[model samples]
Target: MRTDLLILAGFVAVGGYLFSQVWLSPGDRILAHSYNDHYQFEWFLAVDTYNITHLHNPFFTDLQNASVGVNLMGNASVLGLALPLLPITLLFGPSVSFLLAVTLGFALTAFGWYWVLHRHLCAHRIAAVLGGGFAAFAPTIVSHGNAHLNLVSMFLVPWIVRFALRLFRTTRPVRDSVILGLLIAYQALIGEEILLMTAMALGMFVIVYAFPLLPDLRTMVRPFLTGIAVAVGVSLPLLAYPLWMQFAGPRHYDSLGGLAYVTNDLNTLFEYSTTSVGNLGGTLTSTNYAEENGYFGWALLILGAGLALWLWRDRLVRTVAVLGAIGLAFSLGPDVGWYFERTGVPGPWKLFVELPILDSMNVGRFTFLTVVALGVMLAVATDRIIKASADGGVKRAGVPLRLVWAAALAAALVPLVPLPLPATGRPPVPHFFTSGAYKQYIAENHTVVPVPALKATGDMTALTWQMATGMDFRMPEGYFMGPLGPDNIATNEPPPGPVTSVLLDVAKTGKAVQLTSAQQADMLAELRKWQADAVVVYRVEALPQLRETLDPLLGSGRQVDDVWLWDVRALTRE
Candidate 1:
């Protein structure tokens, strides 16, 4: 085989091996967050259930329960960018569904990246291999891919870069724009948020480059409009669920309860110290430089910089200049970085704010733009370098380009060789949380029961099957009457009514109720109106209202079975 082909094959092999060693272990279920496990796993489980009961896969509707909230169906964004694996869940089950999705996502991303580089830059097979290979192993991709379908959508980025190149190089605007439109549609299928961000970046680049082509606006508009129509057509199915939810659902936007729950204060941005680098595979560090910074062809950035410098005398260079500036600004957090905090506002940050879609840009993660900029820089750089090489061989050069390449090769090998040594056992993830009660609960109850789960400790999977053991857990269904709390959202239900409101009509309300300030009076009154059989409160304090309110209704039979299984039947009329 040719050297480039061999190198490309090797890259694929390494990506596959790394995925198996790092991500596919039996116990590698929990992502960094518990919600990831619950949401993604539940989605997969729902797919399985839909196939079994409805005899079809509901790839378009991820909401499982429309009455409570909205959940978008995840499509493997890298491949043909479709929910191609939904039906697979029926054949294999949830675990296998996850495995297949990741594996297929990685493979599709790698292949698509290679095609983009080859088509756009006319890069040698080795360059294409390196580009795709490095992307497959990007630390952010690997780490976040544990549970995030959105991050994996990065596979489409290379294709976007490809379309950007087509717009620049040829007179085939009609063909190129149509292709670009298809890419947008595919990206939307994988992740609407990512698709939005990428489109914004591409649009800015196009407008900047369109000056020279302005005379032919008539020809350009046709393709541009056609591309827009095609993109909209492809995204209809994926958008249907979120659209419905935004108009009628609990949380219209992403949940903001975790680490990202930042205060409006600008100081909070700089105050957070977890930024630099933490426990990066056990290497403590003050600085965040890679063993090989700007590897995988940073030549592009240098080349682009040089182009802008040489063309400093011209307006076309302004395109590269503007993009470079935007990318750099984005890299600096709008509210945190010293540069952005003070100066970002009156400029690009204002642009981001005015555009609602850009809200998902998430200030600190300018890394996306940086990576895309790097690709552009490299493409421009490679074009220049090829021209230079054509004119004069490296041996006749003023600069030691060969030496630079050698140094880069050496740097890349140093860290990889010792790190993934076969002698060293595979990386370990601690199983800090286990559930004996959950396992016992499942083994004991094959039938669905209507009992609240015990205290709710660890992974939701361990808790989910436990909770669903007695009762058939269906979405959009409410059993207990109360205002919906955060805990209720996880189970796909709204909170019960306030305890006070549920007891307002009851003459024996004082005895049966244990009132708390948090419990709404209307809720208790409503519960009383239902003539409920029982009320179960996990927290002891929540029980006081119920106990006081039920005391008179119970009469001689003060039947309080337990917190998890309070016999509310006594509260109802005998």
Candidate 2:
């Protein structure tokens, strides 16, 4: 018990160190590499809290995308974590809540895996700790931790794996299955993509593990089938409505197109990630910092292969090796790449790329399964060494074999130690919204048109401002995923309206275009269509140009508490 507490404390310390930059000034700083994703997730936390406090529907929100709304279930809302942590958000504010969620996410995830490993796989506590630490703080996991709360808070995964393993051996199938079902439902609420990937990995592991036991499979088949059926029966009721809202309901999309192409380069398996200690300021093959999913480094890769060969006789090791190899193959996407060039070879993922749920998945995330396999192998090997040493059988030339093993493990892992994630200053919310001064200009059920407009990409501080106001007012063309066109294809943000397009152009180019009479008329028509009550512009890039663009259409504007405002309620009144 003392050792477990120490291990948990160490995990928490590492997590705190990784995010210390944001924690130092939670309200004023954001993860630098997040690329506005921090704004998106902060808004999610705030909006979820608002929904719960106001007794509104949790699955659908009109706070973003205005009257058109956004399907909350269709996005990575992390409602399971958000709803439960409402008190922290309500007390300290959403920024603090977000920080706390991510920090505890790392600690709890590591601890959960430690508990699982110690109880089920390892006799040596240190072996479990090392394995769990690697599993939770792997390069891929740390990379996602930059912005993804849904992916970061993976404490439930090991528990799900534990219950899944029990299904093959348990006498009380009904009770265990019910528990597993509840876990699955909760994980679904947290992150459906993560749950899907985990299920796929588990299926692969089961198939590989059970293949050699074909004759004995009959004895396990009945309980396994019964457990699966009962688990589904329990989960379906809890998940049915949310799943419906995600797939067939209003604002839902069919698939996130082109994501399957974001795959790992083969060289990424041997390269050092930018965040790792081994990074030497050279060419990095990853798509971006957040997607450095397979930067395991040459040392770890070689060590893992060596461990597999040394422990090949063990059924568990053989299965884990096969699973890791398969996972690596799948992560290469539909077309394989080597040495930063396309190999023109069809990868394993190509076979399943067109399947319904699989089509939506980012193939790069399959490397997560490789991380899990490596963690398992590490724990298993460490346990074997400890047991052999205890039995006085692991000695080489009168030197402890464990000493040599520890040095080799350190050599593999020390280079992969993560650095603190980068952070940058956050733009402060405008006083107009923060001081409730906007209420004087805008009416309820009317949208505020932000200058340059909130968009799916580029300069989304408008989202932070909206969240600061407790989502008291709505906005059009905000950052979110929603269906577009007749086919309901998923778009990052709704197509920008005419007024938004012009404002965005002016914002980007820093030069206002002279609007013709026809263009002015069109802009006004769009304003009326949006039910716009006011136009607010904070300190944005190319502010003068934006003002020049808006002046002709809205006639004039007045400075009001760190913002320029043009109230259009009179023109839009029905």
Candidate 3:
């Protein structure tokens, strides 16, 4: 069969399995919040393309305007996975784009596993498949299915390693630098925190491999410098939006000391029991090894032991040792007491500026190193084992003899160990949109709400900060959860479109404001003072006020879209 067909078949089989095991029931799931952000990002990407191509601006400026890019959520405008989503949507339409992205992602991950192992072991196909299989369906991948594009982006690892090794050997600066640079840039564009972690790991790998090429610094220097250049060049496009936000964005933690506690999130540590033997599912949560099964599957442990044995007699032991050490450190960092102290409370390495980069990565996801390292080790060990066994005078069985033995085994065990068939299921219903009021409007209109231009009046409250920041949306720069009020809004600004609602926290009360009849009138008066579109009642108590104010506004303006209208004049004219 052609490789394309084989690859397609593999993707279909794996995708079918994942959909059945996770999406079909309550048996395997997490809260919607766990994955909603990432999935929503996918939607943002599709919407953003329409925004950028037509509007020329990246923000959703007006609530009433539905043009793409004009009034985008600034936090969401950074084009994280937006580029990847473009081609998939164009090729397969929006409905299948997400599934295609996952398919391609997992396929690349599997291929990466294959490439890493193939380099270590000559041509051991079985071992390569098994290692890739383990990685593609690893627990961390499943746990982070909804929110983590960078974590799932591990599919790029194998290609990076292979290219780096090739560069190390050939000393081709331009080629090596270009590939490495592109990969790093891609990482940065995805998200800054993950990009920083990946850079650290790659740097460590280079240092380890550098020792071997030390005799000729000329080769090493050129490639390294070129790689940096390439990385900078590829990342240039992203410079306009994200880099400045690294320092300027609202930071919850001020010091490295705070990161230790904030990133640890204790609940994650005890979610799974360690006792589930041979389980590798604890990557998301640091559950006990004995209760939730071990995060390192038995196969991984076996490979690690073999790798250790190989190191004692092997010339390339340094490579394995370096990779293993990095992997082990990340794996044990959360469990051990020393790592906890070192990462916090003024440890030696904490002084470096790059330490902030590492800290920002949050310690839990150090598992990428472990998975890649294991793939390499599994490949080498499995190859050695299979070769040694096969070449040791084990006679190849005759065709007839093999057939007879297989028939006898099938004949004997047919009833006891029956082969299970694949389960059938319906297509997935998009829970993300279906439950919301916006879903109905989107379904009826068949297009996402167009964001208004900056020059136009618009509402900014609908957007979350993450979305707003990405788009570079320049409206009332408020956060979904924040300490400050909407003080970012300009004093003489025009009405910010038809008011859907307003969130007012009165008197710093822990309890939210419930707008009463008097409050509703007062709120509308306030909006009118700001040259507002409509008055918003944020709470249930404010509902009556909202109804009173909105009923008049609705009468004056024609309903342009579901949320709000352009204006009462436009409605009267229509």
Candidate 4:
């Protein structure tokens, strides 16, 4: 019937198909099992639960880091996302809520693109659909949908771009300025990196677009300035504290490290993956299965090149091309590589590496705009075909030019269509955490020191434990961003402190290591230092040898509800 309804139905059907595993899973099976999902999203849910219980202040929390705690904004401060999803978490549990947000993020993000292309840029609804679909199902989007909620939840990005353009054209500057401001402020909370990418993309667009209209630039300057003022005014209230906290907070740090490994290679961008069509044997050069953003496939690249060539004079096409080039350049990272081969010729990214705010960002994420630019190019190409035929002048090989372009577009998109995002079965959380047996030993302000305390590796499922129990108790080690140790690196992998690190390494190796009296004394002192009430060992393959090794040093632990726990409160009392 209507274009909006058609777009809506398409978004739901395709987005649902991609995330079918999550939506169709039986009862609590929709749990996030990815590395970041299990650790990061799980902990955020616990933080959200705590925030709701204690008014709306979400800056710091005791769930992670315990005493020093974690500054929420310094990390992935998803309060904008978490607050809205709170009802779902309360009703269906945190895992379900996480899956829901992820699944819906795809559809909403695509719809945002559709709205921009259909309402602002393209002449044909079908053209808009092509752009939106490609944007939503881009290999990179599905790659991230596996875990990273903030990256996937880019529904606001296109709108931000759309309104920034609206400022140049709108007579009602005040209204559009307010809209742009709200979008920026909300995006700052959800995807600050995405906002930066969007700004970069828009800047590239305006630089080229304004050149052609250089004489008219002064006419557009007032509205543009008004939009910026309104955006900063509206966003400053919420963003002010978090920006300061990230830079000046007690636990803030300068470096997060591992900058080179996350770089994108030119060959990797041309490569396909398990998610995309044309092949199932696609491989990745990025660290793991989760962070693969390189694939744009052969089909889109060819078709996009043709469109850019055909519409070379078009402002939007030129702007998209410039933005994509910038993304590719930035994605090369500080140490440039050619398809996994390090060339030793440093890229432009090295300049930004030493800069304050830019250094903290993952260099790999710049490719996000390349995907956005490609989607817009596809829409522009489709519209050109529609126009040539509607004018009754363009024909190719006795066929209407529109039909030819349409067939080519279909050919490109069909072979490159991506599969659903893959899902994995979650490991069971312990009954000690789930059954609430921990309540007896641990209380408010007291901590549960999970044995091994290896948060990213799933060995420290204590974050899940806190989320399961609605965060009734705090835990020492967890998956969160914080400045830690003497050098003060702000990272997800904070040291497990002295005590947990020694025990954890030995447990992982299953080695018989003699603990000296001094070592035993240090462990006990660390317990007191942490203000811990208890320590828990969740059922794992390494538990048996770990227990044998730790019993003599930490004293007898009680086994209850599928967990062995040491009540260290009495021993740690000063």
Candidate 5:
């Protein structure tokens, strides 16, 4: 117990060190590599906190998309985590809460795997620590740690795996099924994509593990099927509504298009990630800093293969190896690429690219299953080494076998040690929001149309400002994924209205255009549709031009507390 506490403390220390940049000044600094996703998640936390406190619907909000509203369940809102951390968000603000979520997310995930390995798999505690550490802090996991709280909060995964294995052997199938069902529901609320991937991986494992024991499967089939049925019965009731809201309710989207093209390059499987200690010159591939999902390094890959070969007799080792290989193949996506060039080779994922749930996922994340496979292999190998050492040791060619194995493990892992995530100082929220000045100008549930309004692709500063105000005012056409086009496919930004398109163009080009009377009438009509109360422009390079552009439609604006505002309640009022 004492040793477990120490190991957990070590994990926490590592997690804290990795995020110390934002931890020191949560509100003022942001993860540079998050690329505005930090603002999006902070907005999620703030809105969830506000909704919970005010007794509003947590699944939908008019806060970002204004009168049209955004379906929170359709987005990666992470309400499962947000609701639990409400006190922290309420006290220290969402920035602090966001940071805490990522920081502790890593620690808790590591500890969860550690507990699983020590209690069920490895005989030695240190072996479990190594395996668990790799499972949680692998390069792929660290990449998502940039701003993907939904992916980072994986503490439930190991427990889910443990319970799943128990179901195959448990006498008390009813009790175990209920527990597993509850866990599945919670994990679904956290990140349904992750849960889906886990289910796929578990299914593959069960198939592979049961193949050799097919003759005895008849004995295990009854309990396994019964437990699965009961588990489904329990989880469906808890998840039915939220699942409906996500897929069939207001603002629901069919699927995100073009994600099938975003996949891992073949070389990514053996290269070092930018965040890893072993990176020589960084990657030359097209993957962005946050999407380097398969950089396992050559040493780890070779070591994993060697370990699997050495333990070939063990069914578990063979099962994990097959799983990892399949996952790696799938991660290559529809067309396999070699040295960042398309090879025109169809990978396994090509067959499933158009499937309902799979279409929405970034296929490169299939490498997550590979990470789990490697962790299991490491634990099993380490257990063998410890047992060999204890039982008078196995010698090969008179070499010190234990010492050689230890050195080999270190060689594989040392290069993969993670570096601190990059961060930069974020601009402070405008005084207009912090002083609560907007409340006086904007009526309840009325929109504040920000100049250069939050779009899917660029500048999300407005989101931080809205979060700073505790989501007190609504905004039009903000950064969030929602249904669009004839098919209602998922798009990051809603279709821009006539006025919004011109504002966005001005914000992008810094060139003002004169609006004719007809255009002004269109702008007014759009504002009326939004039920807009005010149009506020904060710090932006095109502020002057934007003001000139809006003048004809909104009349001359007045300066107020580091912002220019035009109160349009008269024109927009019903």
Candidate 6:
């Protein structure tokens, strides 16, 4: 086998090894986040089913965040992602397809960077392989793998960089630019936020790399700008309508309450997540499971710092080091802090607080660049060691520098390696929903109301139920993003009314809520406004209380299989 293909196969093995549990037991329900991934996978299933059956707008679905519904264009619809996997999802289910996608995501991301390094950036195959490993399997990316699939699908970032460098390095800059544009369009379909972040990093790379060759840059400027324009033009067809719908469509909302809490402390860079195979794991500092990206491990960061100092004159090293510094600073997100103390000082992120799209972005995710930068630096250091050892003119006390750097890299990797992700139990869905029995309760134009509306902390049973029924009927208060109060931040779950909120609490906590006469009247009014076709409550903890509470508003309900069903069409019409 060719060396590049051999390295790619090795990466595939690594990815497979990491996610073996997911593939081996596909039936066992799993989620990276307690709620998000469960809904995300089910959402993919719902959209796939929609695409298979109907010739309609897949983006405008009343199935989730029902009534007004959600504008998927404004949300992480991931439509393009789910489309190609229609066969796999239809046959084995979304869980199996999701696992496969994730495994491939890792492998492809690693290989993309390896291609760039070996073919473009570095000459040493070993250094390129190591760089690919870091770029693809960093602790930061793994931390996001807990729930964020979009972030994990980052194969295009390196590919974009590879082609972007071609704008400067090759004679065929126009061809590279057109391909670069297509890659950007495809990547946006995968994860626009990551693409945006990648763009920022590359923009920094261009400025730093161009400064030294000022006269050469003037000569090169035409092709590079033309390449960018061509890329944007190429992407317009794929992105134009979606972007138009996102900003202008109904049920869309602005971003709010973002990044304030998830920002990294200065010390977080030095600390490692409990998942890392580092000495300081779980000891130095901590953040939310998804936000545990600040760590680059002490060994790697220290070595990268030493390398930056040694190679200050080298444009690539300086660019990477500066990029890492920028990412770290930006990820601080308005606040400056040490390990335990908040200095209350402002960070560079404060400048971006009011900046349109930047406001919504999770500034903490910028730590991704720091991890990438460190990996590239590690590869460079390895290459330098190899060259020094080969030349024999540069040696340390009769010892080969190659052996010294090799040992150091091994030491760094030992602490930076991450533990595999684990799976968890999914709540049971009733045969009534899964076996298409729901068709009896809800008709073509009607919406089913699941009592105790879907919320993140509680079970989002209705979403799975809808998916199981092949989305035969729409449901109110489902897990999706739609417009919300005051500032209009896009909320994940629909805003439940007073009655729904009370019942949701009962369902989740087994705690009863006392209802007053006025409250009872208000709940009834809200239910009528929904014009609900049917109501079903299934697999709940406080069924008796829910039954007693709702009996006053809408007579007794009949039990069918595992669910209690109430036909509310007559009353809702009245």
State every prediction's TM-score relative to the real structure: 0.60, 0.97, 0.61, 0.93, 0.97, 0.92
lDDT of 5 by residue, 1-574 (tens): 8989999999999899889888889889999988678889989999999999999988899898877889989888999899889999998899999998998889999899989989976547877888888899998899788878999899999998888878888988889899989999999878888899888998899889889888998777667778878988999999999889988989988878753356898988998888788885665453777788898988899999998899888998899899999999999998999877989999999898888778877888889889988998998888778777776557767766678788888898888899898899988788988988888898877788887577767778888877877777888887787888788887776778877888888877779978878888888998998888998888778878877887777788899889889989988985
Q: Which regions of candidate 3 fall more than 4 Å away from where they truly are?
A: 1-8, 20-35, 55-80, 87-95, 119-121, 210-294, 297-299, 302-306, 312-321, 331-354, 392-574
**What lDDT tens digits, residue by residue, belong to model 3 across residues 1-574?**
3653575468546644543333344212322422133334444564555455556434333222222112233233335455667676555433244444544666677766765665454547766765665566544344444344445555666665565555545556676767776775565555554456556676777777566667886767665556676656755664645444433433212223332322222232322222222222324344211111114543344446556676545534456556655544553333343313333333222334255345433454555555555555555555655665554543337434334433532332221111111122222222323334333222222222222212212322233221322322222222111112243321212333323233323212224344467656653443333333221122134334333444553353223223332232222223
Candidate 4, 461-524: lDDT as tens digits: 5566777787777777677777765777766766767677776776768764567888788888
- In Å, residue 564's CA in model 6 sits off its true spot by 3.0
**Looking at model 2, which ten-residue stretch has the lowest summed lDDT?**
276-285
Query: Against the unseen true structure, what C-alpha lDDT does each candidate score?
Result: 0.41, 0.86, 0.42, 0.75, 0.86, 0.75
Against the true structure, candidate 3 has what lDDT?
A: 0.42
Between candidates 3 and 4, the lDDT winner? 4
Location of the lowest summed lDDT over 10 successive residues in candidate 1:
284-293
User: Can you tell me which runs of candidate 6 are displaced by over 4 Å?
Assistant: 32-35, 259-261, 279-285, 339-341, 390-395, 508-531
Worst 10 residues of 5 by lDDT: 280-289
**Model 6 lDDT, full chain set:** 0.75
RMSD of 6: 2.6
Which segments of model 4 are wrong by more than 4 Å?
1-3, 26-33, 259-261, 390-394, 457-460, 485-487
Kindly state the number of residue pairs that clash in model 3.
Answer: 48
